[model samples]
Target: MSRLEENILRGLNLIGYNGPLLQKTQLPVAIEGGPKNVEYTQLVNFLTNEIRTLLAIDEEVNAVTSPEDSVAFVMEITSFLKELNCPYTALTDGLVSDRLQNVSDRLLLLDYLITELMGARILQEKKPEKKIELKLQETPEGADMRLILQTLRFPKPPPNISITTLFQKLCPTIPIVLNKAGADIVGEGIFKGFLSEKQWEILGGIQKDLYHEYKIREGNVIDTIGRYHTIFSDRTKGKNELFEKIYHDKRKLLKVEPEIDMADLIAARTDLAIIEKTSNSSVRKNTRSQLQKVIIGQVPDRGGRTSEIAPPSPRNAPMATTVLWWRKRRIYTWGREYGWRSSIQRWL
Candidate 1:
């Protein structure tokens, strides 16, 4: 056997093919380097069977009785390979027309295609398995506990037990109690008979204590809400007063029109114009000499002696009189002016 036939047999064994081994005699022999007249009947049949098994193809492999049948088989295999995304391109028309003539050449082509298909199968097998997630269902006991917790958190008012009991107790012969009511009436009667007068009195006392506590909590909550409202109202009032004081100070300093908005005045910084106007008015009032005296009187002599200051100019007589009146008062005049000293002494 040729090396190509040996390799094909080995490949078939590796791929778990436990059939008869392929021999050179089964394949068509080439005569004098010319094309063989015989079709690749045995070779095509074996290939078709192996392809069907490896690819899990459900279609039956047709018998290759003639060249036309072999061509059709090759086309079918090509279609399968394309669908599987197999990259083997050795099974072309040139393989059938030229290489398929010789036994060794046919075996070589088959070896290549078979090796590729085996590789594809191996890769498919080595892929990671898919994982499945399962959700756990709640049991009946868990569901009942959940329901009980929900009922406790948001309990509904009890039904009218007095009316229900009155009917059942006084009118036991009534059809509603005899037929319509089930085990509930019996259970209620058993529960009432089970407790004594002392037990009932104790339960009543507990209920009254709970109600008293609830009322106290409700009152405390109401008082807290009212106190918070009062505090918030006072804070809001204080904030408004502070804003008004700031607006008043800005108005006095800028001397802007009373109707002018505070936002516009501050944004335009029109206070510079008011300062210039005041400076010009002071100049017109001839207060420069009075200003000079105030500065000179505030400054001490370097030789520990009072400087003999010049008298006010006659032209600045009115300004000088106003300045002299200010100089006669002490710096602690604010307490007398506002009467805060007297108020403090009275409080003490």
Candidate 2:
């Protein structure tokens, strides 16, 4: 027999020697009236035995009840095929060949089945990766929780892991929190009116604080909430002071200098809405000063430089005007006489 036929016969024997006997049943078909030579008989025997061998391998793999047994059968078939040289035709035919061919076929039947099995086994028998399990205990008042449990009886990971593949599998399950500066961050108007009354009160305080600190670098209402708003308005003016108190002392660790990045800070403020929208209303010049006095009177100057500007005493108002008149202050310019009248009459 040729080397190829000899190897085929040996592969057939690996399953059981019953394959050659089964091929004998179909021997008469090869021995037709046309073939009357020794070469024809040899050809018939080779064809019959080879066909039977393939059939037997297919039956053993397909009918095998246990997965482990099926795996073993396939591995042996593939090994034999590989020994005969990997023939791609065997896969297209009724059987499998090439080393690991049967195992590969079984794996292809199910998505990620073979990969999971190998990963699980390697994780158990060897140290491949760091596997940690998180367990949350049950509480009577809380909802029931079900968690998948896996036991990895191993040590540290080997540094040979493929980083490109590792992160692809690990990243999806990790949770992330987006920016909390409300609808402005997302550029949507839907969440604007949803703030509670308490939130508005807190937001008002933040707006005022940001105006004082970063007015040179203006911000919007959204930034007011995110950058300046405080949970406790009375304890301090804004959240910036709180952040400063916590991290300012650790300036070296945080890498923050007294000189601020005015542009970025301003952008954050504008995005958060610390600055109010400008109104187009025109105020009468006389009424405007009076309104300013009323507003300035109501606003409490808490430790700021403006607190030192004491308003004129009730008795000093007349004396102050007399002193200004004695000095002949420019009180009756041509514009002043008509300015108040024109302003009152809604003329300018």
Candidate 3:
């Protein structure tokens, strides 16, 4: 929801209501070489913290005696695990004896132990008959157990596919994909089975908060700025700046417009140009499918959603040559800009 809201905010910026949303807000006074004051890193970190708070998952193994404890202990642990909704393998007595009793055979279950921190093991009975007990042992460390639990919290792993790809090739970054998945699950009323009432409320509250915040920013508060600020993003869902909407607005920063159309000047149409020109959904998708990664881990100034349809970074592998050069030159002059947050330090 935050990502979506951010996209909306960025989209607004591209459209050129360059004015700060409120009287108190406005672009910073243009600063030529002075540093940009931004708190994006803190903001992303805050959002992550919110997610951690929302999940509030406790994946730790509870304190207890060894696996040799009474039957009640076994039953209790089993019940606890059932409530976790996490995948775990339980070894039967026979399975433990065959796989764990022999030193050579133990290798077969090593992976299970490493991943789950628990596996079948042979244990001597405390009885006078001196029989045997097979059980799962408590791992020497809790790291693996916690890791497994932590991953389940997201429910959706980050996508391996590129965000700009026409087809879903890779997943977007974690917060975006995971939260989005969580939101969808909520929307479908499926999360009710797993998420508690409070959890649902918390998450819903977050979404509402995000939405309200977006409304406030758009309708009330403004992003005042007054200096050249480099923008960067993880580029999830091809987090576009929607250059087309804001092209003319951005032009104001330039002393004069280039002879070429802003879109052409930026060569906004490259590989995706042909299909992008058409309004057909299929062709538009193909145009969106195309994506190029930022070479140096970041890109400058998002023009807007499908704004320029060009890869950022004028220095290397730019989609546009002269157009890109001037585009960047204009940004250089604007002094104020918006971008995906990479760190507290804009460039960092």
Candidate 4:
């Protein structure tokens, strides 16, 4: 078996994949040669399923029989990689080509993808799960009684009383006080017409102060009742503020951008540099040849017909020149030729 095939099988085994047996005889003769359509289709389906299983993806895997199918398959993989948040790698037209000819390239890509996924799986397995600590604090000494008094600010309970005893004495009066207050407020509103405007104005001012006091007392009562059940540290103002700050910090951490994958970044930069160099070299070579052609004059063809120089069409433009255009159009093209698409998509 070829080294690539051996690596693929080893990775599959390591990942606990139990699929159809892949053997040397079943694989293509040459690494660069396309395998039979049937074999290629089966292999793609199997590997795709394996990938889905590893990623716990619920998407259905389709069989590849034609170029369109190949394109769809690649698109599905692109989406899967995206969901995984793997470095984006363009893998569309560049892999299959317009004529749908590069079968070997697609096969090689599948091998690489499986390997990357295997590595990702291993890393994921090795990663320790984060545990969030729930820090709890007990109600401190001398603070409990003080908290109970603060919560019952509305009705001043006698000092030095136990919490249970205070509640026992105060509970019966709570409903009675609330009902009497409600009735008095309602009666005042009904009988306000009988009072002079000056008297009404004075009562309004007193009512506002009473309303404010009532709100404070209401809050205190609720807090005291809550303290009876659970002595949460957040009930204390200082600890509550501290916890808020800590929670805000955690939120900020979550909002912070994820770390960039250096390997993918470097690889993408390298590919861009290579493409830029190739594009520049091609332009220079073309320019020099065109100048030479003009200087030397037109040469006659073997059929006695003179060939005329024509302007290069936009369609014939170098892929590098259209890199920005591709990005703008969001036409992701992948394969060995456009490896830079991986990291570039992240920026998009």
Q: Which 10 residues in a row give candidate 4 its minimum summed lDDT? A: 184-193
lDDT of 1 by residue, 1-348 (tens): 666666766776677654434444543242122222233334444565666666676544354555555555555555554554555455443454443445554565567656766866786689677789898899965575456436334343235645455335434444344366674443322122244789767766765665566667766765564454333333357576675666566445532123323223222433335455546876667755654553355666466434656666789888988887675454336556786766544543
| Residue 48 in candidate 1, Cα distance off native in Å | 6.3
Show where candidate 4 strays beyond 4 Å: 29-61, 65-68, 78-90, 93-100, 130-348
What's the lDDT for residue 8 in model 4?
68
Descending-lDDT candidate ranking:
4, 1, 2, 3
> Residue 299, candidate 4: how far off, in angstroms?
99
Q: Lowest summed-lDDT stretch of 10 residues in model 3?
A: 28-37
Question: Which candidate ranks first by TM-score, i.e. highest?
Answer: 1
**In candidate 2, what are the lDDT values of residues 77-113, reduced to their tens digit?**
3443444333454433453334223423322221122
Better of 1 and 3 by TM-score: 1
* lDDT by residue for model 4 (105-155), tens: 555655766776676678778978989999866565446545654654546
TM-score of decoy 2? 0.16
- lDDT of the structure predicted as candidate 4: 0.55
Candidate 3 wrong stretches, greater than 4 Å: 1-55, 58-60, 66-70, 88-348
- lDDT per residue as tens, model 3, 1-348: 234333434533433333332122221111110111122112212222332333443422222233343233334333433443425444223332231233222222222222222111111123246459888676734454345436545343344634356123233453465575774442322122356779767766666665555565543322322131124345534433564336446644543212332223222323333344476886666655323344344468756777557666756555467776777556654544554333323532
